[model samples]
Target: MLFNSYTFLVLFLPLTLVVFQLLRRGNQRMAMGWLVAMSLLYYGWWNPDPSKPWTPFYLILICTSCMINFWIGRFLAAHTFTPKGRLILGLGLTANLGVLFYYKYIGLFERTMEALTLGKFSIPDVVLPLGLSFFTFQKIAFLVDAYRGKTSKYNFLDFLLFVTFFPQLIAGPIVHHNEIMPQIQRTVSPSRRSVDLSVGISLFAMGLFKKVVIADNLAMVANPLFGAVAAAGGRDLTMLEAWAAAISYSLQLYFDFSGYSDMAIGAARMFGIKLPVNFHSPYKATSIVDFWRRWHITLSRFLRDYVYFSLGGNRKGPILRYSNLLITMLLGGLWHGAGWTYILWGGMHGLFLCVNHAWFALRKKLSIPALPKPLAIFLTFVVVVAAWVPFRAGAFELAANGSAQEALRATKSILASMFGLNGFEGWPNAAASEVKFSWAMRAMSCVLIVWLMPNSQQVMRRYFPSIGLRGLLAKTSMPGPRRFWQWRPTWQWTVFTVILVMGSIYEFDKVSEFIYFQF
Candidate 1:
């Protein structure tokens, strides 16, 4: 169920929070089990109709995958650093990836074949199970960690809770074994509950405000803008229309996905289970490499640790390093969806990163000074926004025929317009008041907020999550999140939260799913 939905807001969240907290007073195990049951219910809530064939199968699939991987983790931990351990880890990885491929990529493969043979072949579509990509990554991380002797003793319940925790289950702050497992064992005290509840409510309200009031409104602008471009065969769009469409969707996605991350982290916080910070102020990044560090941070960490390191990372020289970066990005893009647009988006970022790295290397060799931070940030933002053209096309491909070539065409057309190939048409002509509360106004507001205001993490940094970027934040030259308003348990702040939450709730009639749920 969407965290922004009425069912979740009115019934699920409060009810689960109260019951879980109450259960923890007497029986911690029952509380954990209750959490697991509630999480399963939340995951299955999408398919409430019993007649749906994949409903039961999806649940059984997740449970079976969990059970199998849990055992594999245990066995691998038992035999860590042995040849047998490596074999077990390899087998576990293959099984997990094979299942992922079946559910996620087979459709892409089939489409590629159809395009190749000009419709001489076809295959039935595969409906992906909810939480498959996220949970599968967590499971894979667990097995790999066990092989490295990085996992401590873990019971099946702990493993299951780690896999199925409802908050981060749907999308992610793609968590790891060490990050979440130990925290699951703690009992929430009343003092802890009060503070955590305050912080959680604050975060959830901010995220809901972002998603409902901001992102959804932006989607109203972006969706039609792109849909119109696709319908027109990407030929007639003006520069204004193209950039509007592109920037609108980019900000829409940022708020949509990052808002979901905040809700996830916030909800988990209510129960005293902290999730990692998934987004920093990514738009503020001065370089592509820096941007990746801030955006979908957990996923970036996963790719670096598991994928890049496995590919020999930078150890094999610059060529191999660049190759690994490209491969990693292509896979990362594919991870976003089963579409070529997404792959192209990843490839663009990979190329950008390679260029970024090569420039830094040359700067060191030539004693060239770095670009000013503002200039660097502007250039990086433009590059990232351009790359998003392809990614946004995949969303449009839903209305178009979910074809890779169609997505490619949509991307090309939008980009052509953005770059003035379609000719530059100036901004829409409207009086300032007339355009008030319009997409232009909303877009400018979003840009200001992203570029100027402190993020949710900054406001709530007083209460850090269970595990996150604290250590890394300390190491970086960047200023910490302390520069923003802090969240405190004051009645004035309570009133502030109520206003935001009530404002967020006012738009409940238009609740939409978080963008990342599809992945």
Candidate 2:
């Protein structure tokens, strides 16, 4: 179920919270077990056809995978550093990866084979389980950590909860076993319940506003242009239309994914569990390296520790290190989808990262001065925005069933339009004319918010900002204290939150799924 839906807000969450709180007072294990059951229900709630009964099959798949991984972890922990242990680890990795490959990549493989052999082969459809990529990566990390003797002993119940913990289960900050298990153990305590509830509600409210208000609205501006481009079979676009499409999607994706992360973090907080921060004002980053550090922070961590390190990391020479970086990103991109566009997107970022590291090394050697912060940030943002075209195109291909060549053509057309290599005229359409100025204003407004605003975490850290009449009453004359946009728990804050919640509820009738759900 969508976190934005009425079914979740009005029914599921409230009931779960009440029962969990009450059960915690009596039997802690019962409370944990109740959460596990509800989480599984939540995961399986979105079966498209009730008559077909697909969700139960998926539930069994998830449970069986969990059981197998648990045994694998135990085996790895038992055998430690023996050759037998390494073989076990390799086999376990192969098993998990084999499942991921069959479900996610087999269709792509079949298509490639058909293209090469002129339609000599066919394959049945494989239904990819939701969150398969995320949970598989998390489990692999757990198994490896167990082998390395870095993980503590975890029971099956705790392990199940860790893998299927609803909030981060679908799209994740990709929590580590060591990070989450202790928090699960502490959920029975009532000590910080009130504080958790208040903060959690506020965070959830902020995320809701971002998703329904900002991201969804931006999608309205973005989706049509891209759809038109694809329908035209990758025809060239006008300059104005191309820029509009690119900028609109760039803003749309940021708010959509970041908003989801905030909601996940906030929901977990309500239960007195803390998920790691996933986004941190990434657009403000001054370099590609810096942007990766902020954007999808956990995924970057996962690739670094698991994929890059396993490939010898920087422990090898410079050439091998760069090769490792490229290989890791290429796989990372493929992890997002089974498409060539995704591979190109990943390859572009890989190239950017290599260039960034090379530049850093050159600067150190020559004692070169750094570029101005504004220039650096602007350059980085432009490169990031440009890369989003391929990422967006790949996603469009997945939705529209367009081929890789079509995606490439569409990407080329859009890039040409963006750079004015195509005609500089605007696309003449009623929809485009009606919303052009408004869309521009909205895009600018989003840009301003990203560049100037302190993030949710910052506001949460200091609930009271000294602004308006309140600033005059402050004892200190500090400049930072006199800033605007402090998020207090006053009536003003209450009214602001109420408006956001009401607006989000009004939009909830449609109940759009999060963009990250596909990943």
lDDT measured at residue 125 in model 2 versus the true structure, 0 to 100: 77
Question: TM-score of every model?
Answer: 0.94, 0.93
Tell me the tens digit of each residue's lDDT in model 2 across 1-519: 888888888999899888988888888778889889999999888685657856588888888999999999999999888899899999999999999999988877887787788876657777788899999999999999989988888889989999999888999978899888887886444656876766777888888888988899888888777766777544566787788888888888899988888888888877767788788789999999999988888899899999999899988788998999999999989988888888889999999999999999999999999999999998998898888888889865565366887777778888888888987886557654524666755774687788888777656655321112123224444335524565655687778878889988888655678887887
lDDT of 1 by residue, 385-408 (tens): 899888888865544256666777
- For model 2, the superposed segments whose C-alpha errors exceed 4 Å read 48-54, 187-191, 426-435, 462-491
* Candidate 1 lowest-lDDT run of ten: 428-437
- Top candidate on lDDT is 1
Clashing pairs in 2: none
lDDT of 1 at 503: 96
Please state the error at residue 352 of candidate 2 in Å: 0.3
Q: Roughly what TM-score does model 2 have, to 2 decimal places?
A: 0.93
**Candidate 1: segments with Cα more than 4 A from true spot:** 48-54, 232-235, 398-400, 428-438, 475-484
| Window of ten residues with lowest summed lDDT in model 2 | 464-473
In angstroms, give how far residue 320 of model 1 lies from its true place.
0.6
